[model samples]
Target: MTVVSHREDRVQAARSQSSPARSRSRTGSWRPASGHVFVSGYVVLLALFGLVPALYSLYLAFTDASGKFSGVKNFTRSAKDYRFIPAVQHVAVYLVLWLVTLTIFVVLLALVVHRLTSRRTKAVLRFVYYVPGALAGASSVLLWLFVLDPAVSPVSKLLRWTGNDNFAQVIVPNHLPAVFTIIAFWTGAGGWIVVLYGALNTIPTELMEAARVDGANAVQTALRIQLPMLRKWIAYMLILSLAAGTQLFVEPQLVSQASFGIVGNDYSVNQLAYQYAFSQNDFNGSAAISIDLLIVALICAGFFVARGRLFETD
Candidate 1:
């Protein structure tokens, strides 16, 4: 009887050990419906804020300034508006500059930083890079306003080289595109570089080691191996930058405000819309400009979609 009791005790101990493992496995494997309640709330909010506003904008776009239905008149009027095309052109220049500079500088910097620095150093550099981005929007613009001021600027010599003796001269329409590009890069590229650096981390170490064995140098390895692996991330960044460029507002608006219209009023599509809606109280005209931009955004989105496979890995 005692022997049987001892055997039962051993069986109970084995069951206890196995039971916890089984429970853990079950718990680990089990996943509830993801974002169920969160997504439901999100959908409601999207319907209310996103869809409803979008529909109202579309409705307003088709109407005249006084809220009477006037099919396509607002759009046609915008087409003939002198500032319309210039706004588009300004944004185009800004986008081109932003995309080229952002991709080249961010990609190169990220790769070099990752390859040349230790992890701790990389972290510190990333934090430094992200500091300006933390300021963001109006605050960063305020800081740059000081930087562009010839009297107060640290780069006063550089500003004077542009022949810009005052704040107004610094933000001339001709220089706005380049100035905004630099500002955009300073405020935006840090975030992208951080993203690229993280993407670089996901690359398999074995591939890099193989390159090393094959006598590839750091630059060669980065360009030949790392760049290819970052195709998706680059594509993502380009799309995001394109979308953002189309919505150019805060920089130009702030520059115009702070510098007193030396940069002009109809500097960006968004500014043009704001001018109509708030300044002129022409909601229909504003909605029309907004719709035009919406169409442009949709076209851009389509372009990205058409090139979808370009971002995919082999």
Candidate 2:
């Protein structure tokens, strides 16, 4: 009896000692992990903001003008829409210009700004470059309006110098691709410069010195060492820029508005979607067009995701 009692007492003591630890693991560790609440909140917000709208849009895309299930009719109609192909082509042209300019010029400009000046001057120039990007959205559009207005623009002399006698010449249909490219570069390249410049900074000074010792000139070092190091950032920029370029709404819409539809009746797929949903009240058509854009963006994003090793650092 004494032995049994001793064993039971020991068992009880072990259970008692372990209970608090179990409780702590269950309730304490879960009290809050770092970023747990933030991540959870983001998930909730995404559900509310992203998932719900997507589901609703999906539902709408398959429905008719009468809110009845019309199968793929809406999508077919969207494909056959008069403005559809033109909108797609417009967006394609804009993206080509915007993405190419951003990729080449942002990197080149960052390299130039980083190498050509003292630290103070470089910092000042970076601030100036970043200002337009900081003022993106409606404000940037308004600013570009001033810049492109041949009457009062600081570049009026240059525009006249280039034989762009009026705003019409500045934003003609054939020249729109170039014009939007210039505007996009002006507003968008700044943020990217900041990113590339920061990436350049992360390149160890030792690497540059080693390149010098190996008789690599500035151009060679930038092209070989610096450029190679910037590959990941450039790829990331490509993916994001492609996605953003695909959604070419704000610039086109505002410019169209500013130009009083002389720019176009429809400038992009996104504009078509917006007009369908908001103006024409053809929600199904809008959803269908939006799905097309979503697919294109997903393809670009998928490439980025597939090349995951680009993001890794030793």
Candidate with top TM-score is: 1
State each model's CA lDDT, in order: 0.85, 0.85
lDDT (C-alpha) at residue 214 in model 2:
92
* Residue-wise C-alpha lDDT for candidate 1, range 133-157, written one tens digit per residue: 8886888888888999899999999
Q: Model 2, which residues run further than 4 Å from truth?
A: 1-32, 66-68, 305-314
Best by lDDT: 1
lDDT of 2 by residue, 9-97 (tens): 99988886878666576766645365786699889999999899888888889988778999998889999989999999998988888
Model 2 Cα RMSD, Å?
Answer: 6.8
Indicate the residue-level lDDT of 204 in model 2.
91
For every candidate, C-alpha RMSD to the true structure in Å:
5.2, 6.8
Clashing pairs in 2: none
TM match of model 2 to true structure: 0.83
Give residue 94's error in model 2 in angstroms. Answer: 0.6
